[model samples]
Target chain A: MLNPGSLTVIGLGPGSPAQRTPEVEAALAEATDLVGYAPYVARVPHRPGLYRHASDNRVELDRARHALQLAEAGARVAVVSGGDAGVFAMASAVFEALEAGDPAWRALDIRVLPGISAMFAAAARIGAPLGHDFCAISLSDNLKPWEVIQHRLLAAALGGFVMALYNPLSRARPWQLGAAFTLLRQHLPGTVPVIFATAVTRPDERITVTTLAEADPALADMRTLVMVGTAATRLLPRPGGAAPWVYSPRSVPAS
Target chain B: MLNPGSLTVIGLGPGSPAQRTPEVEAALAEATDLVGYAPYVARVPHRPGLYRHASDNRVELDRARHALQLAEAGARVAVVSGGDAGVFAMASAVFEALEAGDPAWRALDIRVLPGISAMFAAAARIGAPLGHDFCAISLSDNLKPWEVIQHRLLAAALGGFVMALYNPLSRARPWQLGAAFTLLRQHLPGTVPVIFATAVTRPDERITVTTLAEADPALADMRTLVMVGTAATRLLPRPGGAAPWVYSPRSVPAS
Candidate 1:
C-alpha cells in the first residue's frame, strides 16, 4: 500500500502573517511536520499535532533531506522558508534532494508555494526602487565565488540595472558587500541611491536610504535586503518630513 | 476639515484568489473605490457601496492621477495591479504622479501593500527556475526602448542570471522576444531551458518548458511570464512521466 505522504514547500513571507497567502496558511495548518531554518520554523506557532524541526541556516540540503524522509515515512511535511521558497530558498534545496534521493520520492506528491519575497517586501516599504528592470544577487560568497559576485555587480552597474542584494552580510562573510559596492561605484555614479532594509515588515524594521558615496556596509546584516538604484531612479521628497519616496520610473530616457 | 481618505495600491496575484495575501483581501474589503486597468479591476467582485474605475492598460499615469484625485476627495481607493504593484506595475506610476502632482497628495494617506508577483507564481508552477541568482526584466518597449531591453537582457544573461521576463510579447512588439532568444543563444548553451508560463495560477494557465533551441516566441503573449535559465540550471526528470522538475541549485561550482 502506498503511503499517503506529501511534502509542501511554503514561504511565510518576510516574517508577517499578513504577507502570507491563504494557500500557505492552509498548508501550514494541515502539515503534520514543520521543517526549516531555526528562526523561520520558530515563526510558525506550535500546535499539538505539528512536530517542528528547526535547524541552523547552513544545513539547507540536510534539512531538505530530513523533511523528505519524514514525508516518505507517511508524514505530511511542510518545509518552510522565510520569503518565497523559489528565490534562493528551500525550494531549490528540496528539488536538489529529490533529484539525488530515492526514485520512490519522485512518485510522492510535492508542491512549491510562492510567498512575498523579502526583496519585494523591502521594495514595497521603500517607494519601489525596483519599479524598473532589476536583478537580485546573493552577496554570500559561500555558494559562489567573490569574483562571480564582482562580475555580476559590475555587469548590472554597467547595464543600468537596479539591483537587490540578498544575504548582503553575515559573520562568515562580512566584507563581500562592501567590496561589491566598491566595484559598483567603478561603473555607477556616486549619487545612486542604495537602500538597506533590515528585518523588513517586522517590528525591528529599519530602512536606511543613502547614496553610494556615503553608504556604510556596517548598516547591513544577514537580515538586510540591499537595493541599489539605477541612474533613472528618483527620490521624491515627501512633505511633513516623512521618508522620501524612491522609485524607478517605468520609462527610460531615449538614448 | 481633514479628509479621512486614503490610497492603497494592491496586487491581485496572478489571477488567483488563493495566491492573494490576507492583507490584500482586507484592503479590498475596506476599499470604497477600486481603480486599475480594465482586466485587473474586473477581477474584484462587486458589492454594495463599492465603485470600480477601470481603464486601458496604456494609461497608468493617468489612472494613478485619477486614484490620487479620488483619495483627495475622501474616497478609500484601491489601485489594483495583477502582480506585485512594486514590480513594473501601478506603484511606480503612482509615485511618478505623486512626485509630479500636487504636494498635498504626498501628505495624503498613501501606502503600498505588497502582493505575490507573477514571476514568482510562475516559478512555483515549475519547480524553482529562480532558485539561484535571478533578475526580472520587462520586455515591453512601450515605456523603454528595445535597445535598453536588449542591453539589460544581455547583461543578465552574461551575469549568469536566471531571468523572469515580464511582458515578453504583445501585438505592438512581436519580434522582441525572438531577438532576445537569439541574443541569449549567442551567450548561453542551446540546451538551456526557457519556460513560458501564460496566465499563471489561473483557470486558463498554460505552461511550456522547452530548450533555447526549440523555444518558439509565438507561445507567449502579454499575459505570459517567460523564464530563461542559466548554465547552472537543471531539469530533473520524474518517475511515471510527470513534468520535469527544473531548478537552480543554491551552490555554484568553483571557477
Candidate 2:
C-alpha cells in the first residue's frame, strides 16, 4: 500500500534562505503542513495554502505529537529546525513521541535532512578552530543535573578535546558558564584558544578569539556558541592575502 | 566605484541536485563563468550558455588563477567546491590566488555561500554523532609534511576531540589511514565510536558505526567521509518503533 502519511524533518541551515538545500526546499514545497517551534515557522517566506502548527519552544513533545497526528491524517508534513534536525533538535522529540504513542506510526515513512550546525558555521568564519577533536556540552541543566554536566566537562577537559558550549548561559543561568570555566581550567592549559561565535551565518554575527582563561562569562548568552580549541587550535593570519582560517594542523603528511 | 568583477565560492553540498541550496543555485544561475575541480564541476547538471572551467585536483592554484581571469574580464564568476567552501575547500585557494595575483584582482568583491558539509550530512543520518565538538582533517599531504599532520592527530587524540577524516586513503596512499590510526590509538581509547559515511545525501548512502580499533581501512576511499567520535558518543537503539539514532548526550535539556 502507498504510504499516504509521511514526515520529513528538515534543517534550515543556520538562518539564511540561500543556505537551505534544494532537497529541503522541495520537501517544504511538497509539504501540506509545517510543524516546528514558533520562531522557526516564522522564518519561512510567505506561502499561501500552507497549514502551519507552531508552538513555543518548551513543549517539544506537544509539537511532535501534533505533527504525527497531522501525518496520520494523511497530511504531508515537514518538521523544521534551525540548524540540523538531529543535532539537539526536533528529531529526538519526534522519535520520543512516536515511541510513546501508537505503534501504528511505525509504518509512516520519515526522512531527516542535514543542515549546517552553528559550531561548523562558527568554525568556518573564524578559521578552523575545530580542526582538532572536540566536544559540545550545553551549560543549562534543566533536565540533567549540573553534576552530570560537571562529570562530562572534566572528562572532556582532561582528554584535551576542543569544546563547543551550547546554551552557555541565560539570565536565569548566569553563573553556569562560569562554573564550567572553572572546571575546564583545572584540566586545560590557560592558553587554549576559545572562540565565541554569536549569531553565526546571520547578519549580526560576532566572532572573538581569546584564551580560555580570558573568556569572560559576561560575553555569552543563549544565542552564543563557544568553541574552545585544543592546545593545537591556533589563530593564523590569512596567508599573505587569504581570508583568515583556522586549520587543524595534520599529524602526519602522506608519505 | 562599484566592484564590477566579483568572486563567489559556492558549495554543492554532498553531490545531490536536490541538496544544492537556493543561494548556491542563484549564484550558479547568475555566474557568467564557473571554475572548480574537474569532478565537482561534472557533478553539476549541464546548463546552456555558461562558461565552465574544470582543473585537475592538485592544481588548485591554476584553478584560482583561471577564476580570477574570468572575474578580471568583468564576469560574474563562481568557484565551486563539493561541500562548504570554507571547510578544507576552495575559499582559501580563491583568496590565495587573489593575494598572489596583481593588486587589481584583489579589489573585487568576494562572497562565500555555505553548503551542507559531508560530515554534517553523515552525522544527521546516524543521529547527531557530531553533537559535540569536532574536527575535520584531510589525510593527503602533497603540500604539507606528514609530520605536521601527525602532530595535529596527537593533539586531537590527547584532547578527546571528535574527528572527520577526509581523503582518508586511495590506491597510492593505502597506508596513510593505517598509520594515522596507529598514532591515534596511542592516545585515544580503542573503543571510541567511529563511523564510515559514504555517498551522503544520496540514494546509495551507507553508514556504519564501529570503533576506532575495529574500523576497516579497506572500506575507505575518496568518496567516503569518516567520522570518529569521542568516548561520549553512543548509539541509541530505536525504541520499539523509531529509527536508531546516535547522539552526544548534552548537559542541558531544551529550554
Candidate 3:
C-alpha cells in the first residue's frame, strides 16, 4: 500500500533557475515542505503553504532525518541539493537515513529527481574537458582520511583519467588541493591543463585555465570546481581574442 | 570580430521530455537547423522553419563538420546529443572538427549547454549508488584499446571508486563487459552491488541489481548504463517488499 506521504530529493542544478529540470520544478511546486541547507532551501521562492526547514550546512544527517520524519507525518517533503542530487549530495544522505531509520519510511514514495551537476556545468563552460574517461574526487578530509584522498588522486592520475575535483579547498581544508596537485604531478605531465571554474553560471563565475605546473591552489575556494585534464586535453586560441576553449579528444589517450 | 553565425551543442537528457532544461528547450526552439543522430533529432517536434539533418550515428565527425559549416553560413544551428553532450558525445567531436577544419571556423560562436546525464538518471532510479567518489568509463572499444580500458578500470577499482559505465555492451563488442567484470573481480569484493539500468525513464526502462559475482553481461546493451558499487554501497529492504534502496553513504569508506 502507498503511504499518503511522499518525499522527493531534488537537485536544483548549479545555481541557475534555468538549469533546473522541469520535473524538479513541478516537484518543488507541489511540495508542502522544503528541507535542505539554508542556501539551497532559499533558492526556492517562499509560498504560504510550503514549510522551509533550512538547517546548518554541516548537519546533513540531521536534515535528512527531519525530512523523513516530516514525510512520515504525511507531508510532501522535498529535500533540495545544489547540482545533481545523486552526485555527492542529498540523495545519498536521504538514503543513508532511510536505511538506518524506521522501516516505515521505505514505502513513503521516495524519489530522487536529478539536475545538471556543477561538474558538467563547469565542463560545459570550457569545451568538453571530460570527453573521455574521468573520475570525480572530493578534496575534503572531513569524512575520509587524508591518506585515502591521496591514494585516489594518485590512482586517478596513474589511470590517465581526466579528473573533476569537488570541494577542492576551503578555510579549514586549505592544504588538500595543493597536496593533491603535488601527488598528481608525479603521474601527469606539466603541460596538462588545470581549470578552476568558480560559481558556474552565476554572475560571479570565473574560469581560469593554466598548466599543471603553474596551477595554484590559492585560486580555488569552497565554491570552485577544479578540473585536471589528461595529457590529451588541448587548448585552442579563440579567433576573437576570447578565452581559449579546452577539451579532451574523444579517442583514447595514451595510458 | 564576432561571426553572425552561431553553433550550440546541447544535451537532451535521458529520453524524458520533462527532464530537459528550459535553456535546452529554448535553444532547440530558436534553432534554424537541428543536427544530430536520427533518434535525438526526432525527439523535437517538427516546426515550420526548422531544418533537421539526421545522419548515421557513427559519423559524428562529419555531422559535427556539417553543423559547424552551417553555423559559419549564418545558420543558428543546434547539435543535439542524448544525455549530457560533453559526456562522450557531440561536444568533443565538434571541438575535434574545429581543431582540424578551417581556421576561420574558430570565429563562429559556440556554446555547450549542460543536461542531465543518463548516468545520473539511472542512479536516481535506483538509490544513490554513486554517492561517494566515482568515475565514468565507457566500455566501447571503438574509441580506445581494450587494454587502456582495463588499465583504467583497474585504477578506478584500486581507487575504490563507484563506477558508472556508459555504452556498456553491444553486439558489435560482446566480451568487454565480461572482461571488465573479470578484471575488477581481482580487486573488489564480490559483494559489491552491480546495477544495470537500461533506457532510463523511457517507456521500456529496466533496472536490475546484482552482486559483482552474479552480474551477467547479457543483461546490458548499448542503451544500458551500468553502475558498480563500492565496498560502502548498502542495500535495504522496503517495508512493503518493494525493491531495496541502495546507496553509498556520505561518510568515508574503508579504503
List each candidate's DockQ score: 0.86, 0.27, 0.79
Model 1 lDDT tens row, B23-74: 8999999999999999999999999999999999799999999999999999
Q: DockQ winner between 1 and 3, please give it.
A: 1
> Each model's TM-score, in the order given?
0.99, 0.77, 0.98
What would the per-residue lDDT of candidate 2 be over residues B107-148, giving only the tens digit for each residue?
Answer: 676676777888778876776666554556677776567775
**Candidate numbers, best TM-score first, in rank order:** 1, 3, 2
Q: Which ten residues in a row have the lowest lDDT in candidate 3 chain B?
A: B236-245
Q: Write the per-residue lDDT of candidate 1 for residues A1-255, one digit (tens) a residue.
A: 887999999989998899999999999999999999999999999889999899998899999999999999999999999899998799999999999998788888899999999988998888889999998899988888888888888888887889999999999887988988888878888999999999988999999989998889999999999999988899988777767889999998787
What lDDT score belongs to each candidate, Candidate 1 first?
0.91, 0.74, 0.92
Candidate 3 residue-wise lDDT at B35: 97
Find the candidate with the highest DockQ and give its number. Answer: 1
Candidate 1: residue B186 lDDT (0-100): 91
Best by lDDT: 3
The residue pairs found clashing in candidate 1 are none
lDDT of 3 by residue, A1-255 (tens): 556889999999999988989999999999999999898999899989999999986788889999999999999999999999988789999988888898788778899999999999999999999999999998888888899999899889999899999999888788999999898888899999999999998999999999999999999998899999999999988765666899898897445
lDDT of model 1 at position A154: 81
Error of 1 at B3 (Å): 2.6
Give the DockQ-based CAPRI class for model 2.
acceptable
Cα lDDT tens digits, model 3, B1-255, are 556888999999999988999999999989999999999999889999999999986899999999999999999999999999999899999999999999989888899999999999999988898899999999888889889899999999999899999888788889999999999999999999999999899999999999999999999988999999998899977665566778988788456
